[model samples]
Target: MTYVFNPTYQLLVLASAFAAVHLLASGRTFIFASHTILFAALTAVLVSHGIEPYQTTAQAPGGLWVKLFYGAAKATWWIGGALMLVSSVRLFLIFEGRPREGRLVQDLLAGLIYTGAALSIVAYVFNVPVGTLIATSGVIAVILGLALQSTLSDVFSGVALNLGRPYSVGDWIILDTGVQGRVVETNWRATHLLNGTNDLVVIPNSTLAKSQLVNQSSPDETHGVTLTVRVITSRSPTQIQQVFSTILLGGRHTLREPAPLVTMGEMDGQSIGVELAFRVADAGQIITAKNEMLDLIFRHLKAEGLALATSVPNLGVPLNITSIGSAAADPSDQHDAIRDVPLFAALTENELNLLTQGVTRKTYARGTEIIHQGEKSGALMVVTRGVVIVEKELGNSRIELNRLSPGDFFGERGLLMGAEEPGFIRALSQVSVLEITSEDLSKILHARPDLADDLGATLAARLDAEAEYGVATPSMRRPLTIAHRIRHLFQL
Candidate 1:
């Protein structure tokens, strides 16, 4: 004869079914395997309760109590199964990496599941019918919704934003309020942005959804950035084009497909303004690229004997011939001394004035010891007016290392390295020098570290090139000779 299951056994079967559903949704193979064992145990317990030789009387209070317990357990099982299904779907969406749309859907579904579970558990425990509890909850929900309308609007707006995909994390956006930044996080109530200064800006999701936004990363990641260069009108348009093209080709960041555009923008009084338009990969690198491009442009122009425009007003006054002669008689002649210095090249009148304040003017007669060998000197000397011979004592003979003219500086190595003078400097002609002490150089460097780095790099390069080639006579004006030029051309 087939055995009829008792109420207690029925309750155990219902609970086991709920547990099995939860385990299946958990999606773990080993955990699912364990759930089979649990299911078997529950079945064994149910079978043992049913097969008991001794049975409780139908009229006994214990039988009625067991029936009530079974009813409650069955309700709990149903509630738990509903919650598990909702939670499982939500978790699956999250794990699949569909956070934008998935999170909102998950939150809504989970909230409903929790509300249902809370009501069901309470009703089951209190012996209240599910229909009556759900009716009461509906009325309470209506009252709460009225009070939280604005807050609810934000929550719903957040959901809309997730679905719309207006902007995602890591995208750079400019809001309608002129606030610009990268999106860092999105939540049910608000979105967070990291501004340029790296400050976090929390904006309401409703506000963001309503405002217009510009996504810099959209369409394409490439951005067109322009650099403007002002050149002297004296430089021919053709030559300017060639020079700019060469510079663009040398730049690592410049895109070749678009070909850097060089347009003559406007003609100013002293300069022919030009705009250099090019495509760059990112906005952050614009400043660095601007600096390097300007440096390269200036260096190329200087090498090509091109001049940039200036806007300084000059005071027209005739020089006193007598004063000029008197000034010429001084150890360092100011006018002639400034002519040959490449370092002073392209400096404006105001810049020259600022330079003069820190410089000491000195005049040297022929054979005068400008710098004594083995002496500690604090100043770097620039040949402003005449030639100076740099000579080092080698054995008994004095080897002439170089002849420096206007624009050339000496004592740089000693000043930079804090070394004693290694060679003697004498006037090849009556020379004038504008001296910059180590202290002044340091102050200038502190004020402009970029200039200091450029100068340091240039000096190091010159030193390396000189060491590779034998030291030349101080009487030689040009640093490079024909043979040196040829070797440089052929050398790898």
Candidate 2:
């Protein structure tokens, strides 16, 4: 052990110690520059001690035995140095932005570099004939190639794939054999994939190179998703199209540029199939997107009184349901709907009657825009029947904010403070709404000044909640300073 401190061995021993410490500290054993320096230092120390490193025959400690030990040491040193140099170069290139080399290329290059260095060490350090080594290697190669035919095929195929650069890591690919996953790693033997179930799948590179693959992330992150549903043939095609379009447009991750397509498909028995096609954020989001679309479709259809024909035979007579939103809501029903709203809860019976009479009842069919984002609206819409989707248009895509059902109200800020609409409100079904305008609210406030405080508190609380969730509108911010704004808007 004291030999480690000798002048001839100090550099080699110190480098070895440093390399071991770096491996332990960093946990990065593949960083080969330190290993390369250690090996080169070992080679220099061994050469300085003796000329010949290996012996063909046995001898005393000072003669043949010493030569043989040094020869073996020299070979190991040179071979390790060559391997480390190759690895270091590959890692440097990778970090320097030449990612085309990848793992397969790095492994192949390392193997070839080490093999050549080993051959040179045999010929130069040990004085073996090159011709004999070549002849022997040729026979060994054939035997190894025959034994590892499948593995060799994978290696060559992996090289071809890396060079051709089809699908890279992080790409979502579906194989011809129905395997769909995101590419996590590509090596000489297999490519690793992370599937929807969070399981890792290892596929041979040879199989992937031969099979057809669809890379949903290649052209861009945008991916098209198609949903099919069967509807009763009794429903009008135009209304069905409108219903499906509204549902698609209201989807959270749905894109609006390509405009969703709703085409009538084949007829099946008593029902007709319709396709709702839309593009979402990416392949990874398709599952959640599909789930959202189905949920919306079920809710919207139920609200519109449309349903898929039952497989069970019905003895009852089929009622012919016609155009949606055609029936006008009765005044009494509108009055009842307004009375249910929490905002109008504080008003007296006479005040409520005045509001009910003053309110304008509007009907909108499916896909109708009841209110658009940024539009000036001084009226509060109370959903009397059916569903309305509140969404915000973000560039070319639309994200659903909330859904409104019967008894739910929106645009209170607009009615009280004269604020602009924060988002778009579209009818998802045959919808009826009772609208209470700013003028009607002002008339009530003039007669009853105490109601302004209740309204102001409610508005302030809603705005604060929206701001906390990062969805606060610019127009709604003014109402958050409740004292002055509410008094001024309501004329209190």
Candidate 3:
């Protein structure tokens, strides 16, 4: 017997079968079971109709039923294709991996699946062969691959970079191009960096693969830095060592183990330059540690009457002499002077006694202003007991030029030629000064013209060197702003 097939019924059967297959592939138990039930019902109906279109003649009794079955099958295929496309999109979103929530993967999968499904649907509707459409797609794919070779390479490279985890977002990296910045985002085509200036930079994935990159913030977030200082040649090696050790110990931010190291970096004719090497948890904290260390060192040196060198204009001949001051009677002062000040030890007892007589002693409490800029110079000050801060007032702000200690001296140039003070001098600690009166200094110059001339020339040279290549004082160095401080703390 011949059976007639209906086109609409056939289409529904095909659609049900396709949907069942799709549900199974997606591993959705409830959907798969439902599709299975629908497929079974269609299969039963097709069988009960006795529609054997493949075996019957072209003009059969159940031709309409056969057509319906075929139509159903076609409809089922389309439904399955749509379900598969949806599953692909869901997978792209749900998959837990690097470049989380990346749009590239989702776009690529959707494009491929939708294009293939849509083409197949159109071909079916027009009675075109599936083989012909697939062949055309293959040819198009080859041409597209060749045309987009560089773009494809970058896409693949981005995948590799993400999987390799060479660096991650918020990490500090130094690229081969010498660009250093924090990673902000990574995509299929490029990676974004937030630079030191807070500017965003987009770098191609291909460039990243070809260039070298240093992940400074990878493996760990903390790093290290260094600080250096210079003291007068008159300062004893032992005293300088002690001062630096004290600074490192007192500093709140410096690391302890593998403790901070102090080394004498250089010996300029009249000064010993020292470098302090220390470890800090973050590069951001380096400035804070440096400031704290400076303050501590200055205060200690002042309380001890150490003298630091100066770099400024000389007002005059600066009394042409060094005074022993009241600290001359203190054994510690005598020991420090003899050990640190070469010029003092170089003189004979009579000369030393005369030099000591010219020196007058003075004390200043902490925060007291010792000398104001523009004031007339009387005697040069040699710090024999405490600390003094040399500052220059610039409009609304006071710029600290340097800190002085026991061996540090100031006012020589101003006293010699009798010029006005070039800046202000304040005490950071209780300061003990050895003051030399201009009258006594004149007498010493007359008695020992050679000594007076040599000392004056040395002081002048020191002043010149300071002005030429002066180190930045604590206040002169820029401080980290609030935004930078927050970023450093959270590593955002």
Task: Please give the clash total of every predicted structure, in order.
Answer: 11, 2, 54
| Location of the lowest summed lDDT over 10 successive residues in candidate 2 | 1-10
Which structure is stronger by lDDT: 2 or 3?
2
Q: Per-candidate TM vs. native?
A: 0.49, 0.61, 0.42
Error of 2 at 277 (Å): 1.2
lDDT of 2 at 248: 70
**RMSD after CA superposition, every candidate:** 16.4, 8.7, 18.6
Model 2 agreement with the true structure over 24-118: per-residue lDDT tens digits = 63423445656666666665665565433333322224456454554555565665567567757565646225464376777777788877887
Query: Over all chains combined, what TM-score does candidate 2 have?
Result: 0.61
Instruction: Summarize candidate 3's per-residue lDDT along 26-69 as a digit string, tens digits.
Output: 45454445455555555555556664212222333235655544
Question: lDDT of candidate 3 vs native?
Answer: 0.61
lDDT of 2 at 52: 33
Give Cα distance to truth, residue 316, candidate 3, Å: 28
Model 1 Cα lDDT, one tens digit per residue, 95-135: 23656546676787878777776665555444457787678
Write down the lDDT that model 2 would get: 0.71
- Please give the distance, in angstroms, between residue 419's alpha carbon in candidate 1 and its true position after superposition: 26
